[model samples]
Target chain A: MKKRKLFILIEGVDDKRFFEKIIKPRISSVYCSINIDTSAQTGNEKIRRYVKSFHKMGADYIFVTDLDEKACITKKKNDIHRKFRVRQDNIIIVVKEIEGWYFAGLSGKDINKLGIRGIINANTITKEEFNRIIPKQYESRLAFLLEILENYNIRAGKRNNESFCYFMNKYVSP
Target chain B: MKINKLIVKNYKTFNNLNISLDQFNVIVGSNASGKSNFLSIFKFLKDISFSGLENAIQLHGGPEYIKNINTKGNKNLSIELNIDFDIQPRLVLSMKPDDQLKENERFEGLGMTFKELKYKFEISFNSSRKYKVINEDIKFKGDLSKLTVGESQKIKEDEFHKGSTITFSRDPSGKVTFKTGAIQHFIKSMKHTQLPILPMQFVKVKHTELFLLEKAQELGLSILPPIATTIQNISSYDFDCKASKTATPISVRNTLESDGSNLPIVLKRVLNNPDTKKQFYSLIRDCLPFIDSYKTRPLLDKSIMLEVKEIYQSQYLPSLLLSDGTISITAIIIALYFENNSLIILEEPERNVHPALVSKVIDFMKDVSETKQVIISTHNPEVVKYAGQENIVFISRNKKGNSIMTAPKNNEEIQVFLENELGIEELFIQNLLT
Candidate 1:
């Protein structure tokens, strides 16, 4: 039997790096038979425009985006589902922001190693607030964050960050 | 003959890449992305046949510079070409390491190994780097089972060769008849010491063969003539119209040089023919409406000067005084109109011309491509508008910095963008095509 081809389209470089480096290594063995590919759309609007075309080309897709100001995650996913003919389960919306998820995953020891001296809460932390804890560079803050995560060996998933782990196990797993 | 596919390995910027060729191909890419390297493959083959492998490699800055830096373990560079004729035949050439050459050898050239069983030839090199043919298997195409017992036995006996394949002599008494004309012509062409077999060489061969040519029409192999003609007719032009204005010494050259240094001489030949001159004038007028006529005059120094006349002016102005755009446009028109049924590769034809006239230049190129093959490397998006998405091949660098060639049909997102959202030029401008 042949496994179906899968393509995952993400919002920006940060989302792409997280999925490729962090989540993929953990679940790749389970879906080894399927051909999986990833591409970054650079913005939310580009993803919305290209998602339908990608689906028409006989590819199952997993779309990942950050819910910046949306009050409810379900509402954002439902909105995307209505606009495009994508399945509801295929869309993963990071709650509050992607940086919030990173902050949620970091422990006290990891924070000290990352050179942060203050206390931070994951649920309400904005991107700006996270940047204050660990200053983000102009080039790419997510890339810097990803490097910190790898260096500290801080695992990111359901146990560490609730939304990220839920999206991975629900949509990305075999 | 038409080339269907090319597979290159360990070549500069192309580490294991395969490209498909069409009648008309326009390669688009950023600088240093390997568009010029792709076209150089044809020139390289012609060079090997003309000057042998060693000189060709030397001309390209030696083996170390030509091989891809990213290649691991194997240093051998190989190129395989699939050509389409009545019967398809593939030609493979591999460049071996020079260390294999014997210590006693004086001439240390690049070691080349070639094989083509259909042509009954296998070429290798000795320690001295001199070319040697190890095998020459001459057999007819089609069904061998149809041959009689005597014919089959005769062919088997004739297949035994212990010397150079080029020296194979046919026995008159043998029952097996072979098509040897094309191969003979190829050998004769190779004997001439030149970097590339030019158009004049083909003309000389045709003139000499017209008298002794037996079997009248089909004496030679069917594929060789077309292949040789394509090679002879292959012309590349990087126009320098400013240089065209200066008086050039008289020369008996028929084809235009890579630089347009021989422009006046070639244009003089074109003007001598009534039909070609009329076509040339019309093409030039189409691109630049203000031009009235063109003529050449002999200078006191026994050189020739090109002069052009405007519609309102009575006196003719020297071609040097013409605008750069006009001179460039005229040179291109002359080349396209005069070089019939030949492959012409142009580099950046959009330079020094008005944006509006760029489409006209592309239209002329497309029109000529109906009878010939035209490959252009360009950065101008306007050329894409006229050439369309199917004719364009995007050359881009991968993550590893190696050049990757892709057509719109093979890239899903590009295909979608062309189908639903925007034209190819629009996508290119938006950086989506890459």
Candidate 2:
């Protein structure tokens, strides 16, 4: 088989770190290579042209967005297509927000250590919700996120969130 | 005094580059495009005036460190400045109180008049890392008023040039020339025994100091000292907030240090002045609203520390407890408002400052520029946006890796973007300014 090239467009630095740290290590294919960039790095207005150019270069591309206020994944994908004209298959929507994925990746012991006392549905958590629940020990939101990233359990992430499971099934798992 | 033009040759990232300047300037460039190098030129001139030529060279990392590696010719570096003065040189005012009358009489006796001065200095190095001043020149130009009969007779008897221009030049061979015969005669009559030793002059070097400022003073020219003083009055700063947070001794408050280590002492001095204190407090309230008031206290060790009182808290927070951004902002305000210099050069004034507060700093800088020339180098798009196209100088590199500088207003493409209502910051972020 010919070698495959892939380009993934993310919203900002946090998403770039998420893909680089979590998703990149799980890719076991010997015939494929991936490049990740953020809209912030390549200005937000120019991302459409960037995706189009990469597509013309015979590289597969993914445009990742958050299903923030949208009703469903289909509505969010349609909104992204209106701006970037990306294909439906290449649009990956994180449920509610990417912060949800950070929570989804934490083990039960990590959740208890964080002082949350109720049942957790990681898919529905927003950034504001995560900020409200962050323990008093961390000084900043970035500090809390960094701690979560340090102790992240990918197996728990796949088990807790359907969007993360679907992404792994499509891109990472054989 | 204002520097109207700069012509540099074989200096660091500049290889035969000439650029015009204004009272307010914002230099923007990509990383490693020589924005810092451009600002360093002013600091280098300042160093040369205060320290000697050899020490200035060593301060900039020795001879070989500054030579342009891309130059295809001999390793010779030169910088020339064309300066225009709004007021007369007032050389007597700067003299000692006792010698002011004598210096004023010396100026009156010379019958010298000039509105513009051009000074150039050049240096070359051999392969052994030894450097020598190869050339130095100063030319004065002014309007010629009608001369009295005695003055005309004096000019005629001395065989001096009749035009309004006076020229002074010295070469590496210790050959000095003057367009005016009387000044030439006066210089020759001075004792060469009092001349300081010219560094790196291993054998057969007759010239004393490499700088013409010292030579002019030694010759009692009464013209070059004030001009050199104008050039020496420039101060460049890249404030180090960490160093600034320490308590500084009260005795070292001559001027704010380049790293802002003496911020406390300077702040003490600033608060003592009622006019500057009012302005400082207003700016502090606008820039940092959380701080309600500030105080400076003296320790038994004769050191002073700065503290700020928060609106929500009753006690004042010491400098050690303050954040880096707070100290950085405070240092910038004091440097801009308190210190007086002919030119002020700041490198990344936005460093450690929040994005929202950067516009306030740039606004203050713009206001300060109206009184004194202000030049800054920044990577912040907010600076590019607020500085406007007319004040922005874009620096980029060509294929050979030589830095090229151009004003953004002169570029037609940028003008078109501006006409279409695109923000300058957008153009900068999209990499369209280059």
Candidate 3:
């Protein structure tokens, strides 16, 4: 069977970069010769058109957008369902901007280490001050955080923290 | 013509790859994979080298030819053939700056424009003449004479009239031109045929007689068991193949075209040439070790027939013999006697011959074709086993037609694969396990 292509849309370039460096590389471990093209900016009109174009390019659309007030403010377009509804099985929406959303994705031993504070946010900080939170390790910290979400299998879901952890240990957890 | 090297850039499966050939090189790949394409790449290079870019481009359809890549994701294409030694040289070529990546521009107007190369170890250019010749980094102006090596022969400055069929090289300063026929002959001589042997169906056998006969004699012959050796002279002079009618027989000869189509004529030719005939008979006697008399005669109007003396059922059967046995023996003899000065590719020589005789058949081909590079693509593991260590090319395929040919890393791998796997076709299954 011809493998379905994965199309990704992000809230910003940072999302695209993060997913490429963190998520995509991890996904590549399980797949081979697959289409995983990505675009960014969740609610922007330009990004919507880009999403439609990628769908035309044979992608099973995925939206890794932030679920903050900015996304809530943008008006919804009409063709969102007509184009994206083609393949329901491969569609996914990831809400990654809430304060505790990153840690809300963790559970078990993962939660014990990273604690309730969630991933220390750097979005509000200026470029120079952004390093103040993690201070030393960059990739290792990112890997540790994402490993939490992957462990729960809720990286693509918004409200699946406790329930997702239950589903994770049931189906996906090693 | 002997090729020196094939430099490929973003060409299909090969990304910036260059293959060097010394006399002979065998390429193996899985089904639907790209071995033939690689060979055709050589063909395309030959076509483009002499045909002028315009005609060659048109014949290939368009820039699409250059833009079609394999799994390596390289669609853009460029190839450089260091062919001065292969057929012609004394030249170099490159695209003009603006058209570096454009195909139509490369072939615009007065046809395809290839950078003209020169042999003099100096760089010179004439903007008015639309040329820039330089010391070979591999670059040059459009000088055609210094193309062939040694005594540069003059070619009648044809404007790629024959396209890849032939092209001449020249030296403008010295008014020298290289001959193009040598290359033409090489192109014409490629092996083209596929029956029980090769799955692909086109290989050309060049014309070489005396040398091939001597080689075949060295390979030895096969003597069949008396009763099993029967002849059916069915190719009659008046038998209309279209009408399915049977008549008398035609004469048999001693040489075979690549297809073995003119097998009868080959028998006749052997009879006519005393030295070759003696070699043919003596070798067959040595290998078979059976008391036999063989002769060929031309029938009245249009055909040939063969007469062979053999012991059958304690009696004798002459002229009327077993076709399968005869054909197998005849093919080996013809292969040895008729192929020379080039590579000989055999399909399956293991057809009707018994398993015991297979080694002899292989040995015959090896003796005859080895000196000139014999390449055989076979499915019979016995043939592979008999070929042993030095010669063998394993083939397999991936989802993409791009082929991956690894030189076994070591022969032990092949041995292990053989001892472990079912057949070559099933070897790829190990990849899934890996």
lDDT by residue (tens digit), candidate 2, B1-434: 67879999888888877999998899998899999888888877877778867777789888777877788756689999988776744221111123433432322222334578889978887888887778888887754332222323442112232435567677888677666434334333421121122222322323424546544554556544355688777888999988888888888955899999998888887888899889989998889988787788888998888898889999998999998999988988887878878788899888898888888888988888887788999888988888878999888775477787888888765565566456788667645576
What TM-scores result for chain A when each predicted structure is judged separately against the true chain A? 0.73, 0.89, 0.44
Q: What is the lDDT of residue A119 in candidate 3?
A: 48
The order by descending TM-score is 2, 1, 3
In model 2, the Cα lDDT at residue B105 comes to 30
Per-prediction TM-score: 0.58, 0.64, 0.38
Rank all candidate structures by their DockQ, best first, as comma-separated numbers: 1, 2, 3
lDDT of each: 0.60, 0.75, 0.39
Residue pairs clashing in model 1 are A158-A165, B120-B136, B120-B137, B181-B220, B182-B220
In what order do the candidates fall by lDDT, top score first? 2, 1, 3
What level of docking quality does candidate 3 show?
incorrect
Say which prediction, candidate 1 or candidate 3, comes out ahead on DockQ.
1
- For the predicted complex of model 2, DockQ is 0.03
Q: What is the lDDT of residue A157 in candidate 1?
A: 33
- Give one digit per residue, the lDDT tens place, for model 2 in A11-61: 877787788788876772632556676675555456665555555555577
Candidate 1 residue A5 Cα shift, in angstroms, is 5.0
